[model samples]
Target: MSSEKQMKVEAVTAPVDLGEGPHWSVKEEALYYVDIFNQNVHRYHPISGNHSRMHIEGGPVTLVVPHAKVSKTFIVTVGRDLAVVTWPDPSKDCVITSYKVLSSVDAQCPDNRFNDGKCDRKGRLWAGTMGATDVPDNPNPHLGSLFIMHNDAKVTKVVDKVSISNGLAWNVKNDTFYFVDTCEYKVESFDCEFLRGVLSNRKTVYDYKTSGLHPSFPDGMTVDTNGDLWVACFGEGKVHCIEPSSGKVKKDVDLPTNSITSVCWGGPQLDHLYVTTTKKGLSKEQLLAQPLAGAVFRVTGTGSRGYPATECNVSLPK
Candidate 1:
């Protein structure tokens, strides 16, 4: 559709338990995503309509960032460890059989697990950890933390006292960074050092308020070429495109499912908008009403464009 308000949403994949982390791979011309609870990594070829999946055994792969230099290699955040996932012979078989742990998160905080993450412009992997679900009734808001994995595989703790770290993106100018801690119900900004993977001067730029959309907790986020943020509202089934300066809504894309998890721009020209959803906490009736809850959806011909996704420039050690 030509109108932004009346954009068409199409289902790209079947259902997943908790679908998150939608990343576009320019090299493969495909969309890469994960089902966190299902512990599966999926790749979809837009042209052939071929969808392939591989399940990780021990833990869930929270996010996948394509390596900037190495083909078929990704800087992955697996469970609570910073790891590298690579397809040694993808031309022969598509299954993922190798993943190496670059560094282990501190064992003192057993409740922490890696969640949503991405890389900065300079190729450093920036992933955040969240409290484990075993203690949902007593979620330690301060236990979660954000970290940076350098090119040499050194990990650094950058932000502390975080809970449910979700969306992360830099402005179009690459001078400012925006991050979301879902428990806070707000999007915060900081001065960014693209080369060093450093952040400072935390300030709230866009805060969420429940309107007709209850529990509009900010989840996954992405930046268009315009520097505006398209943030998925977890319980609202809506994605808000907000301006960074005044924190005002530019446009909203509504979907049929309530638990909208993440969004990214893909396709050849990076003009298509891809979204991920979840069915984790739905009741029986809710599931019945929204049968396509856990599927990945996309909005095509939106008249908007996205920046070329930054690849994970940091390479894992051999």
Candidate 2:
């Protein structure tokens, strides 16, 4: 099957330092995402050009989604724990959850917050980890693993040895899951059983190129209406649209900044593509030059919206 030829970008916010997870709230018609170093999650409206921020009383926030424990609830991943926030109103009345750490291994270091995550069809939270040290000299994927949390708050290590867990997307119809071992610059797919929360038969669905106009590493991603995988390149300055089955580059949307972190499909028809980026880890000289590097941007062309993330089941022992 042949796809489109061009990609476009619309600027939303400036200097999105490590813009990671982008999720579309259809009912609210708002786009939600986090700027990792900024310690904030931003809500943006495309047509009205209005946006708002929720400044957490903690370190950087990496990902946001409809809350796992409650309906109409939202999950905000603070550094070490997942907080539940109630967005009863778009403009006001938000209560943040003081949740317990659901991961089996506790986070004991500073700066090591949850990186990227998504809820599977059965509403199970699948989150990835990064190192706690924020220093540049210590660039290692320390203790990073992919985890699954059930409704009871029981956490299981689905996979380990991940450098940076940045991307999670699945094809429900095919029972196929696409997971990203981000620091390695590739996307791998596995067969999944929703009821059992198990994965098997893994293979490389899409491997990003190191030498090209394509982005540096795939950060956050979502599947399209046509099963196309849309990935945000953390240092590459663009989103790589790929055919997951064939591992072919269909198109790449260029952005003004170099750190494109997360992406989602939105718009009244779910055709609008929203991207979050970062300015984190850049040298002082680089920051001055790319002052607005860590901002958010939008793009539209495929006329596809993202699927809503289901409520994750955290199976806790009573």
Candidate 3:
């Protein structure tokens, strides 16, 4: 395990209220993340050191993933709707020319909103929704579900009765799918049928409560070339690298704040780990104590590289 002093952690973007769902765009050579509460989508280019954000009206924007075939077009989760958005300019904060709502989820539960999401190697978008967290860490339980958005605009619910549906990753071979439901305090794995978009044989890979990592809610996650899981521990302020096969912690990278929200692999070589955090639930005293609570951090020198994030393959209607 590496200590905080041994890791190179630096802030890459200005603070955001509730930062989550980070995606590295290999085509653009930049990083895109969302500010959930503020309803904003942000972009940062590490090469030119340019930072910009576009306000997304209608509802809270939880994620932004690039389209596999379209330039400047992305699939975003706005409130409960899966919308296709287009940003013509990358250098400036410009209005989105196209915001097409494809389909919505949990229409019965208006309080439930989209959380973390990512595309599989097959380019299918897998996202989840959670009940409102009006009281901070204590979210309304069992009002969430995980869904897979097909290329044909079909949304299928894969898992239900979830609380705070978050972090997702697939194995190197694409046969195993990893998921996190924060209230469950465990990391789960399933046999994945990528072609059919089916998941079965669910098993627990890591249990935070049993491991004694109390208060460390598992949030966004990513996988490296070595097939290890890097999980952001929201309350613990650390990212724990776990060997899924054995469910053991291989390394730990601590952050400066407790509200660590999500993480991704970026940089030209994909060797850098990009992390997002939040300041939504902190008190004034706690905020003062942790000054970098809501900043996006870059951690390098981990000796691991991640595969490029898969883009959503669905074609937008003309």
Candidate 4:
């Protein structure tokens, strides 16, 4: 068993429908997340009491992170398309690059879209995918994939046949890359070789048990300064701190909303932990009880900045 971690909730809120990806914008000293159904970008601050939202004309902007160096600019995905939006510029308008969409080949149904995503240590963008709707008739089971978009306008299908491709992370030592099979309720680790864009020796790193405690399927995940994985339990209103090497849950933080979706570490000193939740599949009682459903929340005592996504690096001829 790994050393135990303490967990607590500093704030309770909700977002739109699916709050999957959580990223830290260092320059803004705040966290950015998406409401997949609402097609909006949310910003939250833990220290200065600033929170707001901007509507983007897209179906689901899953992940929004710095598009380049700290210039208040970010790159995001609107359904099957990618676009660039500058921050501090806070304008609803965005600039999208003309990059080819991920192939809509066999096994990849059309209704599906991008899910949990992050940039690697080398400034490459990585994100997972899943069927657009998770119902009985989707027929797209295991149709999702893991993808990497090189700065050179090339994208690689790292892994296919994923059901819910959520929660992507890499250890601080830069040796192992972590992935979450959200629907499978498992987290796996692969050898870290960003330059070569390779994965090997895939092993189960974490699993959410549903017996003793009703931990929802783990979704978007990030690693903290101490190398612990902070996982957002989708069905359960909670986040987990676990040791990846041993697959042991060290601590659990309960969220006010029952369906907490994702988490991240942000702030000037990297001590604030931000979380996002959903209000999509809820009953009247559940919605009323968790009125802040689909809102974003923050908490202290979680300590350490998890990691920031890298922008797809574009190199110009020298």
Top candidate (TM-score): 3
Give the alpha carbon lDDT tens digit for every residue of 133-173 in model 1. 62223356667888898877788988988878889999876
| Model 3 C-alpha lDDT per residue in residues 1-318, reported as the tens digit of each score | 555455799988888999999999998899999998788899999999999988878888999998998888889999899999888786689765448998899988999999999999878899999998833255478888999999888899999988888889999888999999888888899999889989999999999999998767799999999999999998889999999988999998988999998999999999999999999989999999999999999999888889999999985788
Residue range with the least summed lDDT across 10 consecutive positions in model 2? 92-101
TM-score of decoy 1? 0.93
Which candidate achieves the best lDDT against the true structure? 3
Q: Give lDDT per model, in order.
A: 0.81, 0.70, 0.90, 0.70
State candidate 3's TM-score.
0.96
RMSD of each: 2.5, 3.6, 1.6, 3.8
Model 2's number of clashes is 33
Candidate 2 local lDDT, residue 171:
85
Estimate, for each residue in 22-125, the C-alpha lDDT of model 2 and write its tens digit: 88877677787776766777777666767777666666677787754555556767776765655655444243434444453445545455778977776777
lDDT of model number 4: 0.70
Cα displacement (Å) at residue 134, model 4: 3.6
